[model samples]
Target chain A: MKLVVHMGVLLGVGLGLGLADMALRPLAESAENATDINDLIGQTDPDSGTPANTEPDVDTPEIRDPVDDGTGNTEPVDDGTSDNTEPVVDTPPDVPVVTSEPEFPRTTPGPNWPAHHVTVEQASQLFGRPDVLFVDARALDKFEEGHVQGAICLPLEAFHGQQPQILEFHTSMDFPIVVIYCGGGDCEESDAVRDLLMPDGYENVYVMHDGWPGWVKMGLPGETGQGEFEGFYDW
Target chain B: MGDKDSCSAGCGMTRWIALPVRVALGGVFVFAAFNKLFITNGPALFNKSIHAFKLDEYGMTEGMMTLSTHLVPWVELVAGLALILGFWLRAAATITGAMLVVFIAMYASVLLRDLNVECGCFGKLSPFCPKTVGSCHILQNATMLLMAGLLAWWGRSAISVDGMLAGKAKAPADAA
Candidate 1:
């Protein structure tokens, strides 16, 4: 009957496509930190399967607490600031140091969560830094409404078409610090974009954890309408 | 030429309306299924989207959710194609209608809970996609459900392959 023929073709196409998807998927390269947030924080190194202990155990210089260096001082003597007189050394080229002024107060003491998280103050400081690039992962309209002052728009919905361009551009730049964000805590687009990039060995990437809403909430500067540098984070 | 009863004005109107509805419904299914079938990481993303729905909260296992994710797209593709072709019109309409009901329920649950996530209906295609379902998503699905119901009620169309085949079969019977 005509019924049998039509059903046959329909099922054939659907099953054929589905089976092809299952079979071919394994051949593709897998992501190093796909769907794993802890990986972003350096809690578990992908290759080692153990906690990456990066803390240094060297002795730090003593603080120069001023209590009138005790020689029956009538007037306080001026100390030219600091206990250590040793000149600061420049960071080696091989090391990827994420340095910033201590602008934000920290109540908790520990290693910063790698480059995965950036506080509002830290993100603000990162502005205008030649090595830092802001990535907006929300839709183009949302990007047009408002975003970080110099952020690149890369909406997850259009990832398929725009992904190649990002991969190529970032690769050429040798992977600068990419500070990515979406609408905010409620939006998962930022995380999705980060996951997409991680497989290709982009390690310097950081998530603007608070997201764009958080930036707005903090009263940070933002730009409205289309950016001159849309899609790619040229700076 | 003497078959006026079989081609009444009411019947003509029903067939004309059914033709567009069937084709449109079929096209939507094909388009939706094509993206789900071919897009890179489509299956994985779909599985994640289903998990977002908190089906696990409803006592569904990970394995069951995984199977549904794999199977649903193919069924939609097949049913949609069948309806468009007007081959086994009644059967195809019934299947499509049932699937629409399931989709409506799923979208309704998402709306009720107020979860913010992609609908995954069109596999990242924008404009057509109701990103993070609200009233819009429910309305879209409801419209599709009505179309499916109408297709089922009409059951046949003069412009379909089903109609042509029936006419050919009747010719042989008449000659005999």
Candidate 2:
């Protein structure tokens, strides 16, 4: 009886303390303003106190500017803000916003183009189509290094925390056809993000089967270094 | 009576030595649990780390993982506090020791799989973190296990509530 009483007291204290901590935590990092991968397991550089970039050790010349359309649409520039907020992508007036799925030619069920899988060709076809939005499910550093041109960085690890912003961003795009991808073959992050998006009323979602490496291997137009991407907004 | 006095003196010295070990084991658990339970998105992060162990391959479901993520911290917290107070020292030490065993096994599994993910045992307080579950984490758990095992072997200490109770019970028996 004495043991039981002591155990009960300890249990009560633990539960009480746990609840108090969660409830009284600062609201500075709520769902809407939650950061990307850096907030989720990203290590801080002990010397700088800033998140250290965890990008793969593949060095390539940084693309100096965004792909200029010659329509006076200048490149998207990062504000270089200390908060690490992703630079907002300016939607040009000419960019088409599709509210529904579109009819595309070539519907072959190849190994790379299975149902729910978009081949590199298929992804390229959808690229800049205004109806398709590519979502990069890799870490922020990797996403910054190189991604499908115009791809939005919403890493799989931080998906739950950044779900609100993802949903809001898609809603702004009128819920375009979202093609999600990560590092490449065997990287299940894209599939995981797709699973998450489906429950939230996001239809027309497809996992890019080729992934980022697939795009790079195929020599498809790619952007390196913080192109037009939505970053974590630390408010 | 001389033998009893000498034995008592030895036991008293042992208790003093065991006190710090008990306190250390208890303090570690308390700190670990406090971070896991209280930090922002602590439970969710812990849940992710648990899943990274690939328990699903061993037939553990997402629901069970989620339950464990929440349950483990409270168990650690209660057991830790009990050990610190020296109330139910045996039970507390046994529980903590068992937990360490499980932790050691999980980290060993991580090593076998060559996974590169944080242990997340102390939430954000993993000061020695390679930020990955590796040999260091296993060694840490082993150290804790040793402490808990020693506490269990020593039973109660002289500076404890349990010891006071034992003394009161013995006094009544002597008077009778």
Candidate 3:
């Protein structure tokens, strides 16, 4: 009976400590945040402490002028308030937004194409389409290095969390097609990406059954995700 | 008192060491039951449990889930307390051994099936994450299985109630 009582006490202590440990986590992290900034740099709490980080704005950071002598240390000598500010002479004209209609080939099984896997030739034609929204659902780092031409990087994991902004990016397009694809055959992330835009009543959502390795192996026109936004033909 | 008393003292020391390990192992099963009870895909865990125990022929229904989870935690907690307290040591060791075999076989089936499901041992928290199809960090489980084998093979230490009572009874008989 004595032994049984001791065992019961041990069990109670273990469970009590476990619950108490969870309740103390926030308290511990907040206590850490009150320390030196450099020591507190990498401390991360999934749902807390981020907003209070704004309190570290004690030192005002320098904002530079639009044009400067190549040296970054140069002060804003082009201050507009100068008596010789000279009425803003040699000002550049506002450039008009280009609305060029680039012709692109369309795909077979055009919209709401379910489980009908596309071949390389079919994908190549789809890639050339004007309306197809190709998404590289890889890690951000992997997507940044290379992607299909006219493709955008919205990794499947990150896409789910930021769905509102993602939906708005293509809100104006009519019957827009999004071809989501991931790394390879083993990765089911392409299918996992039934994210906000798909069910938000946008028309077409097709998964590239095979992925980037497949796209590149077929010698299709491809571009790196890393470079400049404009002039991506030979990228 | 000549030979057996000396043996009993030696055995008692080992029982003290074995007690903590048994409690730890039993606690793992208790935690497993707690998760499978409340947080798991409940019907799914029952279906898997039936399959793991090779009870698939009975056609597992939703009704059995409450029974399985309830029985399992109590069994684990009782066995844990008994083993740690050196009460009914042989029975506790035997049951712990059996439980470990069940865990090993369950994970092995998961290995063969290539199911893309986390082993819901701890349910929502720290689910058994498989790195690939049909395999996990298999070595960690293999080590636990080895510990179970050790406990089963050498659980005859005499610090238990069985030894204390048996020794005194034998002493009066010898004095007679």
- lDDT by residue (B32-147, candidate 1, tens digit) is 77766556556555666677788787899977776666777887888888878987776677677777788878888887887765677776564554567677777787888889
Residues A12-46 of candidate 1: C-alpha lDDT, one tens digit per residue: 67667656655555312222223233333445556
Off by over 4 Å in 2: A1-235, B1-10
- TM-score rank order: 1, 2, 3
lDDT by residue (B30-62, candidate 2, tens digit) is 898887766655665576678779989889997
- Candidate 3: which docking quality band? incorrect
Model 2, A138: alpha-carbon shift in Å? 9.4
Query: Which one wins by DockQ: 1 or 2?
Result: 1
TM-score of chain A of 1: 0.48
Candidate 3 lDDT tens digits, A1-235: 5334644554445445444433553222321222221122333334633222322111212323222223433232221111111122222333222211100111122222244333233445456567667776776667666677767766665645554455555555453566777664435666666332443333356566446655554445567655444432211
> What order do candidates take by lDDT, descending?
2, 1, 3
Q: What DockQ do you compute for every candidate structure?
A: 0.14, 0.08, 0.03
B168: Cα error in model 2, Å = 2.6
> For each candidate, what is the lDDT?
0.61, 0.63, 0.47
For model 1, give the interface RMSD: 5.4
- Candidate 2, residues A55-107, lDDT tens digits: the string is 21223223221122323323332212111123222323343433111111111
Weakest 10 consecutive residues of candidate 1 chain A by summed lDDT: A101-110
| Ten residues in sequence with the least summed lDDT for candidate 3 chain A | A99-108
TM-score (0 to 1) of chain B, per candidate?
0.90, 0.91, 0.61
